[model samples]
Target: MSPLLRYPTVDELATRAAALVTRRPRDARLERVGTSRAGNPLLLLSVGHGSRHALVVAGPHANEPVGGGTVLRLAERALADPALTENADATLNLLLCLDPDGLRRNEGWLHGPYTLGRHFRHFFRPGFLEQPEWLPDGADAVTLPETRALLDLQDELRPLLQCSLHGVDVGGGFVELTHDLPGLPQRVAHTARRLGVPLELGPYDTLYWPSLGPAVYRIPPPRRGDLAAAITEAAVESTWFHPYRHGTVTAVVEAPMWGVRAVQDGSPCADPTAVLRTVSGTLRRDTQLLERISARIRPHVAAAPDAERLLAPVDDYLLVCPGLADTWDPDTDDGPHPLPPLGSAHLAALRISGRRLALRTAGLLHQLVTAAGSDPADALPELDRLLDAWCADYLDGCGARWIPVARQVEYQSRVVLDALALTARRADSLSGEPDWGSQAAVPMHRE
Candidate 1:
């Protein structure tokens, strides 16, 4: 296997975007789209002019660096092969990085080896108010300027397709769509298999959303809400509002960062109840860790408003845990499967891995607080030791390993192209235009 790869630093990423702009001024314009709470300018790179538009937003979360490469690939591809974007009728309105501040904070891991240890050590994700993608729109919500910028762009563009490219720290590769299109599932699955990547046939982030087939899915209705939405009336990314408002086909791509074969192994589990217990146990332990750390650092977090912002995930997770679906009951059948298409045991273990990854932000905050001299009693070392063990368990127990940067980007690019083609074909058919032969059709494979 190829060794894990590092992504360009934030400065290098900006230079690359600038290069793309200079390469095809007629086709591309890199402009400031919005501003982060930290006053960083959020940029949007627009390339090509096609019949329909596909808006690709990346870097919604701090650690998921794969999308930056994917966006660059698609933009350069459009500049090089005009027909590629034309055939898909996609103008390629791309948000290179929505969270520049977050990206800079994650630069330690971003421009280094994408290992689990490095990630947890340098982890940093903002609270609901700080996250642009999940910023709330309701009266009580404090909407970040970046969130407003995205909503404004959506209104102005009214895009035909929107893709928020993301990466998962573990488990299988999967895609979620706001509107299901014919043939997408097969395409996504075939692409994953082509790369020797496991499809997320088991439960993961989009647990409540209905799957179309295999790893492809139609995102849950906007009314259903999410972890952020639970805290705010209108969580930006969770509801997937583009589909309903603009008639856009919104998609979220999760390329796995680590893998265990069992993530895709579908078989009848010898015991279903045991799997559920294991899942519940992990959740219980994670929640307990969050509680201990948050309680220990609550005063410091309150004293230092910045610390409060850092502890948002821990706070929000605790706030919403009672309603969160991490607790699965065997008799309830509240998961993808009790057996087959991923046996209960394997899928349940996946739940453990996801929780571990999610709670890492809390652990990171613990480290931050202790390092800052907030804990007079040095409450963090004992907790940090336990956290170290959990991280080890995640890496060793789940068979965590690097998913090369190139492979991850390629998988995302393939899926986005396939989706663009499907949407473009639909546009042609809906227009009642006479078939322009090959132009009217999008081949599943490259010519």
Candidate 2:
């Protein structure tokens, strides 16, 4: 168990961030930027004295926390290396954790030994709307309290770049860009390759989106059929989509909580439809199982304090996603090439997505059932064991292993550092000044 693999608690992160500013008081200061929906303070640490500003946010999704560690460590880097900060020439505005209310719920397993078993035992992911930094579908008029804090800062400062650090349950590393800056995709590929993290060649969530490069996808201006899946999600707007001032180009970095070798297997499948059948089967089975659980607990759901919020994910899974899966046909895609034949990796990624969705549904539903307490509460322990067994079997079948939090942090921070250098170079080029070159100028920051 490496210390890097152990995620810091929200309080501990705030304490350590404060200490960083205290030690380098002249260059850094910590302030409460805003409050969470649950009343937890959102701490933003401002580091360095650069003309431009770069906003780095982490923990936008409660379960994906590689960015939280990256934010803390990157703050330290900004304080210690003057040239690194001078080149990017931007103040590092670090939001240590964007969704503290949701993250606090996942702290049970964040403390260490990041095994699938422990994760299944302590897993908790709030519904899309309940997780911060999202606006409900067709309700762009609203902003989450946590997201409002970021928007307020973004509007006032208009930073040069914004980074949303995220991680996956299990898959390869990938990057999403709001703006297609030159040389960034190369930097991401090099970083993941050097760190032994496989790049995500498999596309599921990124499906139908344009690729900026290998494993790198452009987020906005959704490609054809993108919103078909978007409509199923309650809050589809993440942090990156909110920034506009200074044309704050955003980059979302994602790494896997556990590394799965299959994500990189892009070889052809003998019978691709067979893989789709497996995916369709898994989705229906998982949905039916959860529906049974819901039927048992329905009598008490209305009494729960957070019933509406907790039920959103279950409703989406039971009503929307499974319906699509049931009628989905490989022939539905009238593209130049067939859909399912995209290969084994694509199929594997689809299965991984389904399994993750099931886990999310089960995690949130159990919370709702427990809070609404009745005889259904007694059924939770057995339900948990069933999920645990499912997870254990899937982990083995997929050949997945725990990924150290350190590698994930390193990949994300290095990408930010290089992006800073590259963006600066582009700015200099426009001003008729010589290119500052890449991170090769700064030995300490190269991947």
Candidate 3:
């Protein structure tokens, strides 16, 4: 068993990971990849002799932590799995917690002897300007020690695969990023299946509306230079999109730990011994398939027009690039307070524009419930209701906004209702019965 998983704490996790690297009997080495704004070391555990390397990072966002645990667990497992540790064809290096200060804020939950409810509540805070992870120094932009560390490490490591383990809401499903890595999606799907998590697909755009898509979208047209079009300018500033700017071509997987408890029945096997069998199996399959596909396409990465186009789907995330919503001012509580309840008009528009995506997302949740060997019909509606209420409270109460945040509430309400209905229908079809005996099973799907 890994020593770190024995006790959970932000400090303990980092210390244990560092200790593991220090004590590694393998030929690999431990190095400092980056430092948090608070000066916490972003350590990298590097193993293998292959030129092809994969970088795994977690804790990019303070609230989302499954990746931190995953990286630690993966490191310990790799130590014993010769196939993972003895790789001569590729190397795997992990960046555990890019934002240690943000991580520090959530230490109570990580090393918790607390109840699950308290742990979850205590750790769930949003990323704001004050967060060490988001605020880099002005002008240079990359001045944030953590960002600099990662940039420097990327230069030094030149990883071919980079997976940042992240989770969405308590209601999220697993998803992977990147157009590269052959059979990458399948591996992600398979891993989620083994873990009893679901995959999110569909209109995630609504989640990033007016910032990324057909909804008043503004992505800073692919280039820089001119404010207006000229008749015959000597130099033309063309707009271009660099997908790599925000994401990596390296294989990236977003693992949702939202339903992790359901998937593995709340298994407390945080240690290498308990989790090694699963991690090794998943990694072996993922690597074998990913390598085969990558080998076939290695020659084309350079020639691919609009290199960013390849990353479109995976790069799309609400948290990556947020909307133009105002941040909550800590100094003054004078902002959009007492958010209006979601309106009917906004709800209608969201339903029309976001139905498909909502359905797809719902399908992912359904998959999670079913994969856990739980009756989807029995579990999904309850999950949907819980998520809806949670979203409502989150959008409305988390912080004061000048603009009514109720639109988000309404959007989520409609989304939750629709999801519940859709999941019920799908579960019925699979089970060949339309019976959900509980009265609570029925959602307020009418609206």
Candidate 4:
């Protein structure tokens, strides 16, 4: 068994964080922000008694819990050494897990024996509109308890620095920053290399955004009446950095669960247009398949008590994805635009989409089975066969290659710690304060 498989559950992580704060009562304080939709306590661990503060948020997406481990390690480090933040008069505010309801849905594969097959089997990610961090309109429409809690915290703390930890399905890690801090991208790249994580250089789903380095990118602010805005209205990143008036330098670290050499190869392609056409075609097929499956199960699911809530997002996604595919223009540019090389990252992205669709389909089907009061054996055999076949195909297409969980945590923690150190050093330099020895150095790996 790999050491990466040895990760703590949400309950265990919360208990551990509470214990750390309890042990270092003088330097730390623990507070419950609010309860999740599922009634899990959302915990915040505040370390150091400094005037300036940095907010670290983890586990916003249920599928990407690597941030949870990273936050725990960071809180522990801050508690052990007060000089890490006290020297700069800064406090470390850690949110252990934001979307506990989603986290609980994914807890099936989080404990041990982490495999790609098992991971996707229990995977559940709410649609973008359904997520707690971002919604279609301003969070003013936000009904989720978790989102409300986060908004309240942002209003109260108004941190100087905010770090949202996120992970990818496969390929290399990347950094997204709100502000162009000097030397930060380089430091992030260096840290990733030292931790033996690849930096994805190929065209990702968000390739339209300009890149600062191999994998580092500057997140563009959402424009009104645009797709980005429509998709991420009042997102946490934009809210914290733009209108919040806190001068918060927000950073998002997206690390991967697996890596391959092809993710970094940016070689010119023979025919970029053909590649775009192929991708567009795949999307069209997937959209059609989802529509067919939804239609088949709709009558059954409609009678369930929570029918609309369970099916609306999936329907919206199905509608939007096909429309996006229809709008793809492969010949927009006169000059050659190289196709993004197909790599492990590409495969991983496809696999993730397939798994999500399957999960949604299964949910609808399960509702149908229950509403009809049919025997388990009498449920739709055709739907079951199709789902089983899709899962097998997804696994077969993307070969098994897992990155150790410890390495993933190390990369995330180092980037976060380095950001803190850099922010503190900038403050010290401005104030003409002497640098604190050793505490100012950013370690390649956490001690």
Candidate 5:
């Protein structure tokens, strides 16, 4: 088995990672980021002597294991190479796995071709009170200890080029989020090209405003109080009145991993090692540009007030444009764009439907396991009951306009359940301990 497959458990990962680092002890620093809600410690492996703040965090959602795998592989290789860490003017901080509690819910069976497919399913739940993204009055209500650790580290070592690595399946190929940094587009494009990574621009993708013919989606402006109508209202209002904001960018990049995978997937050579080589090459090509971008932002970093002022509008805009889905366009090479915000009705309907679908799937799986006399079925019925309420709350009265989004939501539901079933089966096989819903419901709390 590959080294990637060999490291399964968290202990195994830590042990193997530490030994790999020992091969070149002088360059990098290995330290704990913080403990998870479930008492698992988050880890960061640093590379580079220069403290010119650069951060790449992965596993924020827990189920998204690809990002974690990519970051860990980079860390391991960087530790081995040493040059990645000992660069003259920049420091690289790697937050390998951010949400350990969420991660452990599907532990032991976290990786592989099969696992990746399952992970893409059931990975998204709306941000709740405990989520890092759920900020109430500018303060997080349920700040997981892991979140606190990340924030504390950010305060202690303010990074200039930070990447909160995440993935989406909206067909936005290799999407990147950009703040209003000078020369950002060119630099991002250049880095992407060097790495053979493709770009799909956002604004044009949604405006249905392609370079060529009529718009792909030419629905007339939605009527007042309509979901689409409200969404358009919000999008236009934010663009005009609200401080024109940019989100997910503090000199950040939101590269869509699967889109890049598509490039390799279609190629004649589909070897994992070669594919990774392509990925590393693409990343390494951008090394100097990243360093330059970091250095260029230094004056802004040094003058903390200036950086804050620059980012303030962006912060304001992001607040107004809730539910900003990432966008991409193949023709323009512009990279990710913020999708028009969904109106409250549409958004609510989508969430409720998703929740119900998830719960129903879980309940059905629980029934299967229990009937087989393999696992306890305590929470299955509760899950089913909750599913009905959630469905009622979100999906009941919405008219036909939401059919498409609802369809997508339903698709997402099927995928999530399928993946969870796979995860459960894998868990059962791994541990002699019988599966039990009584084993604390996968702590999904919505505030």
Candidate 6:
């Protein structure tokens, strides 16, 4: 347990950030961006004196709060050495945590007895449609106050660079960029290696997305009205970084909570079909388990006063996801070449995603059970026991191990610093100036 993993709650983060800003009254200042849907303050720390500005955002998703630590550390580093940013002509603006309401929901396991069981027990992620990172479509009048606040800041600042810090539940780390800048991928890979975090080479979340390198991918801006498509399209389109399209040069660091060597292996399989079967088989098993839990809990949920609100979303997610598993057809060859080997990271991601869905369904069921005033003495505990046992089995099967919080923070921060330095170098080269030899030379982009 690294001291870095002493994950702070929303209140604690606000308090600590305020103190840090107060100490450097002349250089650093804190501002209230807006309030979350739950009314927690969305705060930002402004550091350094320069014409160029960079915005660093974290905690976009409740489950991926590792970025909160990274941003906080960066804020402290910038304040301690004003020369760090002043020389680069870059001002650092840090949004400590974006989704404070969602973050509080995950705080139960933030300060760990950090075990897989405890983490899953306390997990809570909103549906794709409800996530703050995804901007609402025109047809849907839904809008999150947090999203509006961040968008307002981006429009006002039009930052030269924007970095969104994120992390995974398992497997190695990866990077996502808004556009391809020369040598940026190599810098990202080198930073990960130096920090001892393996880069995930397996097909996971980015299976269908375009790749820039082994674990680096580009995030395409959503076309107009694309959010009105399927849930997947809408989810991808909701990325907050996309709206800053005026050459903002966005970067996302997705480190993992735990990693294994299997995640990095990309060797070809003699029987690619068998690999697909294995992956599909895992999803099937997870789906069946969730279906079983849902069946048992449905009766109680239906009897609850707010039954429609509790049951509809959980039922919808389960329906779409389990069917998605059946869509994996290795026998069909639609591509120019043979199917690639199913990487360990892909398998881990599949299993983890399924488990999260099941846990989320169980959580919803628990709420319904409690709300209905029904005696859930047996059903809720059974659901938890089954889910925990399944997670333990999955971990054993995948060979997953714990990663220290300090290491994750270190890797994420280093990547951001390296990227900022690279951007500065690019700006200098374009201006016909020589490299300043330090990250301090990195300048924020001019409008």
Best by lDDT: 2
Q: Please list the residue runs of candidate 6 whose C-alpha ends up more than 4 Å from where it truly belongs after superposition.
A: 1-3, 136-142, 224-235, 239-241, 302-316, 331-356, 359-377, 429-447
TM-scores of all predicted structures? 0.86, 0.89, 0.48, 0.82, 0.47, 0.86
Give all candidates' CA lDDT scores.
0.68, 0.72, 0.39, 0.66, 0.38, 0.70
Rate residue 20 of model 4 by lDDT.
85
Residue by residue across 239-355, what tens digits does model 3's lDDT show?
Answer: 011123433333223333322122222223233232323323332333343233333333434244322322221122121211111111122233233212222222222222222
After superposition of all CA atoms, the RMSD between model 6 and the true structure is 4.6
* Candidate maximizing TM-score: 2
Give stretches of model 5 more than 4 Å off: 4-9, 76-84, 113-127, 140-142, 174-178, 181-447
Candidate 2, residue 147: lDDT: 72
Candidate 1 off by > 4 Å = 1-4, 86-90, 138-142, 224-239, 300-305, 322-326, 329-342, 357-362, 434-442, 445-447
lDDT of 5 by residue, 27-107 (tens): 667788788876887888777676444566666654344455545555654455433345334466777667666555445
- Model 3 stretches with alpha carbons more than 4 Å out: 1-8, 112-121, 124-140, 203-248, 260-447
Model 4 residue-pair collision total: 0
- The alpha-carbon deviation from the true structure for residue 43 of candidate 6, after best TM-score superposition, in angstroms, is 0.3
* Candidate 6, 1-447: lDDT as tens digits: 454766777877788788887888877888999899878999998887777778889898888888888888888888776555666566898998889987887888899987877776666666656577775563244378888787777777777778888888777888777766566667767777766777787535666667887788877666554322334432255544554565577888788887765667666446555756665566667667667767876765676875675566566567665454554446444322333346555554555555555656666666566667765445777767765776676478666788888878878887787677775566666778743324444333222
RMSD from true fold, candidate 5: 21.8
Q: How big is the positional error of residue 381 in model 3, measured in Å on the Cα after superposition?
A: 29
- Output the TM-score of candidate 1: 0.86
Q: Give the higher-lDDT candidate: 2 or 6.
A: 2
Better of 2 and 5 by TM-score: 2
Task: Give candidates' CA RMSD values in order.
Answer: 4.0, 3.4, 23.0, 4.4, 21.8, 4.6
Task: Give the Å error, residue 2, model 2.
Answer: 7.3
Clashing pairs in 1: 266-342
